[model samples]
Every structure is written in structure tokens, then in C-alpha cells.
Target chain A: MNTFLQLLNRVNSRVLFFGLLFVSLFLIVRNNEAQGKIFLNSAGRVTGFFGSGATAIGSYFNLRRENEKLQHEISVLRGQLAKDQYNTQVNIDTLQRVLDSTRIQIYKYIEATVVNNSVDKPKNYLTLNRGRHHGVKENMGVITADGVLGVVRYVSKYYCIVMSVLHTDSRVSAQIRGVDKGFYGSLVWRGKDPRFMQLIDIPKHNKISSKEDVVETTGFSTYYPPGVTIGKVFYHSIPPGSSNHLIQVKLNTNMANVRYAQIVVNVHADEINQLEARAKDEQ
Target chain B: MNSSSTLRISLKFIIIWILQIIVLKQVQFLPLGPYYYEAFVYPLFILLLPFGMHVNRLMLIAFFSGLLIDASYNTLGVHTASAVVLAFARPYILALVLPRGIDEAFTPSLGRLKFLPFLRYVIYAFLVYLPFYYTMVFFSHVFIVEIIVKSLLSFIVSVFFTLILAGILNGLD
Candidate 1:
């Protein structure tokens, strides 16, 4: 205790010098309004500078999570598009139509990240980080921004498996754009190239004049919306003695490296199915 | 430590303190834009304190003297903090400027050191004092340009007045 006191005694001048300085600084910050404001503002600026720097570095590590959040937001925005809504306005009269403008949202998109995907296999499938809880049902059409992916085959509580467009068994009803009422056919993969698909069963009687004819969804099935472009018609031929044309189509979406996809939820699917079932029962 | 010397020192302190508050405090030079600064000669008391005085005692005396000026100006700690810095630096500055073979009890005076050396000492002391004083006044480096301009301007006017005051005083010499 005595030695400690002696040690403190030797440094007492320094201690007092610093103590008085601290007191002066405290008084300046506490008493004078302008000086206090300057001090507080400068201190706040310093802390804020460091805080934003830390957030910048932390955000770099959080890119994947941030991407997922943005994807979800994009899905919500995609669902609100005018094309995604169904117009239920039956033309009773022009005046009545002006009074009644009813647009029902027929499709809601649920965004999902591709956890696993394969294009090299004969039967390719994609695993998505979405499930029944995310409103992804089996038979819901999966699509990217460019083209159709496949139908959702199976769904769990937290995940779903989608049959990719590159798969052998995958079939999509596709149409060719033309001036006349164009023809549509079942688009199928020929188990060879992942980038190309075969659109078959279009009757050769339909005039094929343009080389730039675009292959798109016919909207015949409940799987996809009308006019969703699947690909461009690359080549077509009437197989010997066959009445129908077999069209080779170049797919727009690159199936090998797809990272994100949206599951299309058709809201009136159950109603359409019931109506179709009644017609089948009558037959 | 004699009674007469003590009396003389006290009288000098009082005289300078009074002269600072009453006369120098009101002596406003024309404002040169935002670069205006006040003249301070109260620190001359700390500057001219006996060379043999302990640094700790010197600092305490300087602190109180500064506080007295602060009360009059309503700048409670700004002056005190600057004065304490001047008091703390006095010994080192004196060590640098004090001539060789000087007596141990030497107190700095105009008559003893004469004009040039005394001016040099005053310049060095104010060099330390004014910048620190302006720093305490402004309280932030955001006004760093203002601090430098004010310190330079105030240093010139202050040194001029302090030299004139020291020259007139007989007892201090």
C-alpha cells in the first residue's frame, strides 16, 4: 500500500493535469450550447461513419440472403402484372361494360431459388427452395424470365421438385405466331440436346411461310398463361407419309445454369377442373 | 519565499488580472472577416512566474487565474484549459530560451532579458498559447481553418500589446 501510494505520488502531477483537462472538456460539452452541439455532432458523425462501413462489409457476406429477399419481392411484383390477370368482362353491352370493369388475378407467382438442377440427364429435374407452404402445388407451371421451365411434380412442407424442360417426358402445348389463326402442337424433348425441343402434331395444311415464326404457349392446358414464348421454330418438315409437321424449336431459357424460377398459381384451376369433370361425366 | 517577494508577485498578478478584464478585454481591433480573435495578456502572469516555482503549483495558480477571467467572459472552461496548457509548457519553453549562466532564482522580465530575447520568449509562449486557446474556443476541428486564421491574427496583436505592457512595468523588470 505504501509503495503504491509512493508510485501514485510520483505521477500525481500528470494525474492532476489530465484530471483538470477532462473536467474542462466535460464543462465545455455540458455548459456551452454551440460548443456542446459541435462536440455531440462530431461524435455522432464519427460513430455513424464506422457503422456504415461495418454494414457495407456485413452486406457483402449477406448477398445470398439479400438476393433471396429481392427475388421474393420480384415474385410479388410479377403477380401484379396486367398480363397475369384474367379479364372476366363478358360483353353484355358497351355501356354495361364501361360500368363493370372486373379484372380477377388469375395467377400468383411464388419465387423459388434453384437449389439443385441438372440438364445432362435424359430425365432432368430441378430442386427448388419452395414448397406447399409457399403456394407451390403439383402441376403448377414453373418458369424463368425467358421461357418455361417445367411443371411442379412433387411438393413438401419446405421444398418442391420441378420437371425441367430438358426432360424426355416433359410436354408443353406450344403455338406458332402468324397473321392467320396459327397452329399449336405438343412440344417435347427428343432426349438429345437440352437447348432444342420438338413441337409435333401441327397439321401440314397450315401454311408455314415465315422462318422467323415464334413458338409460344397455346394456353390450352391449365399449366401456363397464353402467349408465354417458349422458343423460336428452327426447322420443320412433314415426315414421309405423315399428315402433321414436326418442328425443331430452339429454347430461349438455358436450362443448365438456371438459378431462379417462379411457380405460377392459377386461381381458377379448381373451377375449370370441375366444369371439365361435369362435361366428361355427361359424355 | 520572502514576504516582500510574495507581496510583489501577488501585486503583479492582481494588476495584470485587472488590466486584462478592464482594458485589454474591450480593445477590439477591426473585424477581418470571420478571422477575428480576442487579445489575452493574463497568460503573461503564468509566463513571468518565477523560474524555480514547481510545475504543479504553477499549473494550479494558472488554473484559478484563468477561471477568474472565464467568469468575467462567461467562457468558464475554455480560458482555464488554455491557461493550464500554457502553465504546463512554461518550464520547457523557459529551458529552451533561458540564457546560459543565469541565476537560479531568475524570473523573466523585459529589463533582464532585454528586447529581442524577451520578444522571442513571448512569441514562443504565444505560439503555444494562442492555437490551443482558439482550439478550446471553437471546440471542433471542423472550424480548423477559422482556428488557424484567428490564432495567427490574435498572436500578432497580442504580442504587440504584451511587449508594450512589459516595457512600461518597473517592478517586473
Candidate 2:
């Protein structure tokens, strides 16, 4: 008894602190009103601020790793640039004025940093540093320098979240690289893997069959510029009695490692949207 | 142990409470940039209690003081929760900081513990209090990053004010 009292006496100052904490929590939970709600709202704002502060600290600690990543990224970009220049020049002679306009900037790329990103879930979203104030808006197609990613799902004044193409609802109009210009299909993800998406609705009779066929955005939609490399067709299957082939694609740009992305804002998006809206209205 | 020391603590409590409710309570960071938090030194009241004070008494005092602060700030129970926790952690902090634990008659003050030791102890206490306060306020695992960031930033600012106040009050001299 004396020993316990001795211990208690040693730590006596905090005797009631724990007891009160529970009772206080109980009061807080049970007796909340408008005042408590106001505090809650204020707390949300504070927590957001603090969360970013922690992120900044994490970034600071990860600066060395980030620097190494950038060095590797730059070297990769340099190699890709040489190849891209040659390819663009070779394709320019054979392509139409629409394709020519794409190279001449029908779409502008806004440089942005990935503030936050996720890819584990079925519906993965990424937050970009650009927002409504930075001319980013809802549905603006986002992509890395190498390939297509996803469209802007939501935007605030200074930040926006990208709904990655890995999501089930995300569908992009994509085409195989070849002689046939009109052979495009709706590309969709099967919600299984972040690294692969499936292109469905391609007519099985299209007869263009190849194992390593390259895929690119068709520019049939205003979301992505034409000829942005999406992935390579891994394999295709004619689903039993169905007339369409579902082609499995391996995405070129790894959605999980996307650090910096260029948000593709088609200058003609507004005009195209209006035209589409009017056509829908008439229908 | 003395009436004079108890009176001094009461006086310190009232002055700090008044300053907190009227002035420091309104001190919140600008809702801009990456970090947003409020630097609170009011929990220092619990930290300043005499070392040998019974835990039960200390916690009750902390609770009341926190409730009063909450009532004024329009955040009913937030300050209470934080204050009680700070009080609860005080003895443990003392035990951790002091190599010989705590003297039965020791009062946690700048005079007895010295400036640097006091600073270290107060900083540790603030770290514990601020993070808990923020966690309670946020109430979600999603804001985990925000809680940490806010706690760190708030720690720096709260420590600054706490040091200055500790220097001024000088505890039970």
C-alpha cells in the first residue's frame, strides 16, 4: 500500500488528468451544438494546412531521392526527344492538316507538379498543383510528356484532382498505328491492374491483326491530342459470339510513378463542347 | 507547498487564461500557403503546476481551465481535451527529463530546472499536446499528414511563446 502510494505520490500531479480527459471527450461528443460545428469547420481548414506542412517536411527529407529521380527522368527524356523528332518529321509528310495542327499546338500543355497521387484502389485519383486559378478546369485531359493519363475530375481555386484512366469510368478514344485512319475504339480499364487497360468495341472484321500493334489517342475526342502514345496491344480476343474484339493494352506511362504531368488543354474544347451540346439538344 | 506559491500559480493561471481567451485565441495562421495552424501557449498552465501535486487535482484544474478557455473561444471541449492531456503527460515528461526523476517539493519553473532543460521539457510537452489537439480536431485518418504538419508548425510557434511566458512568470519564485 505504501509502495503504491509512493508511486502515486511521485506521479500525483497528473492523477485526475486522464479521468477528466474521458469525461471531457464524452461531453464533447454528446453536447456539441452550432459552436462545436463551427469549431469543426475551422479545424478542417487547419488540418489541411497542417497536412501540407507535413508533406513539405516529407518532401524535404526525400529531396535527395527526388533529385536522383529527376536526373534519371531527364536522361530518359533526352533519349526520347531524339526519337520523337525523327518520328514526327517522318509522319508529317504522310499526315493530314488536322494532325499537322496538333503538332503546331491546337492543344497547349500546362506544366504541373503532382501534389498527391494514389493508384491502389479501383478508382485512383491524382492531385495536381494547378487549379481553376491556373486555367485548369473540369474535364481537361491530363497526360505525362510520354502518354495520355486522365481528365481533370474536380478543381478548386489552387488545386485539382485527376481521375486516372485506370478508373472504370474513364474511357478514351484510341486507335492502332497503321494505314487505316478510322479504326478507333473506346479504350477502357478493366479495374484489375493499373498497368493495363482494355480497348473494346473494335470490329472483329477490321482484319488488322498484330501482336505488338502500338496504340495512340485518335483525337476523335477533344480530351487528348492526336497521336499521344497510350500503349502497345498485348493481345486481342474475339469474345465468343460477339462481333467486337477486346484488345488488352499495356500502358506505356506507368500511372503509379507519374510525378510531373502536362495537362492538355485543347483550345477548341469549348467550341467542340458547344457543338456536341447543340447536336444532343437537336437529337 | 506554500500558500504564497499557490497564490502565485493562481495568479499566473488567471493572467495566462485572460491573455489566451482575449488575445492568443484569435491568433490563427493566414489561410494561405501549405501550413495552417494556431500556436497555443495556454497549455503551459498545466505544465507549470508544482511537481509533487497530486494527479487528480492537477487534471481537475486543467479540465476547468480548458473548459473556461473553450467557452470563450467558442470551441467547447477542445481546449479542455488538450489541457487535460497535457496535465496527464506532465509527470511522465518530468520523469523522462530529470535524470533523478522529480523532487517531492520541486515546482517546474525556469528558475529551478534552468532555461535549456525547461525549454527541452516544454518543447516535448508542446509536441505531445499540439499533435493530440490537432488529431482530436481533425478526427480522421485522412488528415494524418495535415495533423503532423500542423503539429510541427504549431510546436515551433507555441514553444516560442511558452519560453517567453516561462521567462516572465518564472514559476513559484
Q: Per-candidate DockQ versus the true complex? A: 0.22, 0.22
lDDT per residue for candidate 2 within B1-173, as digits (tens), equals 57787798889988788767777778776643687777787888888888878776677788898898878776678788988888777878888776465576767888778787888899889978998888777656678999898888888888888888888788345
Deviating ranges (above 4 Å) for candidate 2: A1-18, A33-283, B30-34, B99-102
RMSD, every candidate, angstroms: 20.4, 23.3
How is the predicted docking of candidate 2 categorized under the CAPRI scheme?
Answer: incorrect
Worst 10 residues of 2 chain A by lDDT: A86-95
Note the chain A TM-score of all models in turn. 0.64, 0.63
**lDDT (10s digit) by residue, model 1, range A1-283:** 5574455446667777777777777777787788899988887687678876655777889999999999999988987999855333322232122322477667667777798999889999999888866667899898889899999999997789999888899899889976584778899998899899999989999877666788889888788888888888888899999999988999889888889887777888888989999999999
Residue A49 alpha-carbon offset, candidate 1, angstroms = 4.9
Clashes of 1: 0
Instruction: Report the error of model 2 at residue A81, Å.
Output: 73
Best by lDDT: 1
Residues A157-225, candidate 2, lDDT per residue (tens digit)? 778899989888989999998876459899998789888899888898886567789999998888898
Best by TM-score: 1
